[model samples]
Target: MTINRHCPTCRSRQDFRKLNDDEKAWVRAEGSRSYVDNLWRCTAVGCLTYFRIGRINDRGLLPEKFKKEPPADAERP
Candidate 1:
């Protein structure tokens, strides 16, 4: 099964490509507990952006954590 989340840039639901071992290790090192942040790239057409999702209970990454409110000063994609 694929884990999909909304793209922060495009606001479209997109499947993500899993990060490599090095990237996963880096994220794990940066966080506490077992809350390893996994990096994912937006797979929607023309909306290739990167975002992070947190792993939960060793089950899987939760997509809800990936949603972010756009900064008021930021431009929409």
Candidate 2:
């Protein structure tokens, strides 16, 4: 499972780091194949948003609830 180290709030690709080894392992255990409860913190200037990184399945992660739905125009003939 690959975790993204980018800040979801600011969308910054730098200055963001993963949690400690122990924490990561714990998160993996708690999450399922469809979702991994990984955590990340942004350290760019004033941006201090803590976010959860997880696997993207038909539905999104635990905290961020997302459901996939087809486009409205897909049924057009």
Query: Taking the tens digit of each residue's C-alpha lDDT, what string does model 2 give over 42-67?
Result: 44544534445442122222222122
Best by lDDT: 1
Model 2 pairs whose backbones collide: none
lDDT per residue as tens, model 1, 44-73: 544435555653222323243343455666
Cα lDDT listed for each candidate: 0.52, 0.44
| Candidate 1, position 75, lDDT | 66
Q: Assess every candidate by TM-score.
A: 0.40, 0.32
Q: In model 1, what is the error at residue 64, expressed in angstroms?
A: 27
lDDT of 1: 0.52
Pairs in steric clash, model 1:
none
